[model samples]
Target: MKRVYAKEDVCIGCRLCEIACVVEHSESKNAIRTYKTEVPRPVARNVVEERGPLTFSVNCRHCDEPLCVAVCIAGAMVKDEESGVVRHNEEKCVGCWSCVMICPYGVIKMKPAAKKVSKCDLCNGRTMPACVQACPNRAIVYEER
Candidate 1:
């Protein structure tokens, strides 16, 4: 399965990944329109971490043996076989944060208002994720290696 990987050496920590992630998952469909205050808060599935000179975006790996799925007591997380994307079911979630605690990358975030967990799902139906599309530097990409 081809997965999205990062070349940390090329990353500038501009956070286009985070913006793209949030836009892709938004309900408004229109990225610009979704930014209005009336629209719900945008949640990012990928997050960037900065440590001095290095910075990189982190998201779900969709691991073959995912620890987050195993630790989710509410069974809200599932890995899609065809796409190798880990999806979250907000309805089933109990907001327990077990997945957050067990995720090695710390990519999962708690949606305080929604009372659920959110993470990258790779824009399952789209050709590419919003983050990948919005990145001007091509820091984030979807490809098969």
Candidate 2:
């Protein structure tokens, strides 16, 4: 299965990836509208991390054996056998934070206002994820190893 990977060496940490992700997942799908008018604020599934001079983006790894799936008490976290994508169902989520605590990558994020967790879903229904496409440096790539 194809996954998103970040090449830290070339990452400039511009964080356009995060904005693109918000737009892709937003109701309006417009950068200005999403950032300006959206209520509750749409969260980016992928995040850019920086320490000193080193920077890179982080998102779900969609591991073959994801601990988040195992620890989800409400069964909201599921790994698609066919695509190998781990998805979080907001409707079924109880906001217990089990998946948040168990994710080894620490990519799962808490949405306090919505009482749900958010993580990378590989931009579902897109041929390429928003993060990968928005990466000007080509630091982030979507491909299978």
Candidate 3:
């Protein structure tokens, strides 16, 4: 199964990954409308983190044994056996924050208004994740490794 991975050494901190993620998840799927007109804009599932001169994108690892899936009491977090993608079902979520607390990478985020948690779903339906495609430096890659 393929997963998204970050190449920290080559990352340039452009943050195009974040923007692409938001746009890809948006209802309009248009950058201009998603940023300028969309109300309650969709959040980026991936985040770019910086520490002084170092920067890299952070996202769910979709672990072989994801703790987030294990701790989700409402069974909202699930891992697809074939694809190895950890998916979050907002409708089934109970807003318990169990997944949030158990996520070791701190990638899962809580949606305060909806009382639901969100995480990287690998830009479902896309050939490649938005973040990996938007990365100008090829800092993010989707592959079996």
Top of the candidates by TM-score: 2
Model 3 stretches astray by more than 4 angstroms: none
Residues 54-114, candidate 2, lDDT per residue (tens digit)?
9999999999999999999999999999999999899999999988888777899899989
lDDT of 1 by residue, 1-145 (tens): 6566776777899987777677666776666766674245768888888899898776778888889989988888988776677878889999999999999989888887777888877777778777777777777777877
Candidates 1 and 2: which is better by TM-score? Answer: 2
Candidate 3 C-alpha lDDT tens digits along 1-145: 8889999999999999999999998999999999999888888888788998789999999999999989889988999998888989999999999888888888988787888888899998899999999999999999986
User: Which candidate order results from sorting by lDDT in descending order?
Assistant: 2, 3, 1
Best by lDDT: 2
Least accurate 10 contiguous residues by lDDT in model 3: 109-118
Model 2 misplacement above 4 A: none
Error in Å for residue 96 of model 2: 0.7
Cα displacement (Å) at residue 104, model 1: 0.3
Q: Which TM-score value belongs to model 3?
A: 0.96
Give the TM-scores of the predictions, in the order they appear.
Answer: 0.90, 0.98, 0.96
